[model samples]
Target: MTLTQRQAAYEAEVLRRWQDQSDGAHDLGHLRRVWRNCQTIALAEGGADTEVLLAAAFFHDLVNLPKNHPERAQASRLSARAAVDWLATQGFPAEKLPAVEHAIAAHSFSAAIPPETTEARILQDADRLEALGALGIARMFYVAGAMGGALFDADDPLASHRPLDDRAFALDHIEVKLLPLVHAMQTTEGRRMAEEGADWLMSFRSRLLREIG
Candidate 1:
């Protein structure tokens, strides 16, 4: 199948599986963006397998768990297993399954598994990109609201005098996790993109603080 055909098939499967999921942050659009980011990073970095990256990107969030779930850290591992099993049934290349699984499994920040392959690193970087910039801001607040968290600390929005608590304030998540992701990007291209996205996040935060004050 052509790359476009394969992408459409994968997306269809993902949508079928996620039909009941209520988390808008991890929806089909998010998966498509991750795949696009993977392709961009892979093109700049080179040597990544497109097929592996495509499968990994589409299936990375197969087992989407809530941020506050007790097994949130295991979601990526579970997703990898589920993805491999489903792909195996669909006649995907067996030799490439390990790479796809590793990419999906290592893509999660909470899982903390290191990406050992180029595809894995690209997937990790691509997924992390979703947690920055304009889209990141929207997802951050959406997730915070889903978890019953506040928008920001009224008096200490930037956490100057107090410790950052993302659970208590959605704005604190940019400092606690999003900004740090720029340095955490595995590929050089990914880092460059992440830096831009992080800068945008910072600008948004500045605007938000100014408005609140």
Candidate 2:
């Protein structure tokens, strides 16, 4: 099968599995965007196996867990295992299974597993890119709402005088996690893209603060 055909098959399977999930932030659109990000980063970085990156990107979130879930930190590891098992059934190149598994496993921020291979590093950065810029802002609020969190602390929006608490306010998430991801990007291309996205995020925060004040 062509790359496009393989991606389509992966997407169909992912959609079928995620049909019962309620997390709007991690839907099919998010998966597609991550795949696009992967391709872009891989092109710039080179030395990455497209087949490994493709499977890893599509299946990295196979075991999606809510941010507040007790097992959230283990989601990526579980996803890795699940992806490897499923890929084995699909007759994926067995030699590349370990690489795919590592990529998916290390892609999660909470997982804290350092990416060891080029494909793993690229996949990690690509997945993280989703949590920045316009899409990041949308997802931040979406998740906050689902978890019964407020938009921001109206009186102290940027957490100037108070401790940052993303669990309580969506805006705090920018400082708590999003900005740090800019520095955490594994590949040079990913870092460049993240810096730009982070700047956009800062501008949005500025506008939001101004309007609220």
| TM-scores of all predicted structures | 0.97, 0.98
Error of 2 at 141 (Å): 0.5
Computed on alpha carbons, the lDDT of every model, listed in order, comes to: 0.93, 0.93
Mark the 10 consecutive residues where model 2 has the least summed lDDT: 14-23
* Tens digits of per-residue lDDT for model 2, 4-86: 98899999888887778887899888888999999999999999999999999999998899988999999999999998999
lDDT of 1 by residue, 7-92 (tens): 89888988888887888899889999999999999999999999999999999999899988999999999999999999999889
Native-to-model Cα distance after best TM-score fit, residue 25 in candidate 2, in Å: 0.6
Residues forming the 10-long window of minimal summed lDDT in candidate 1? 14-23
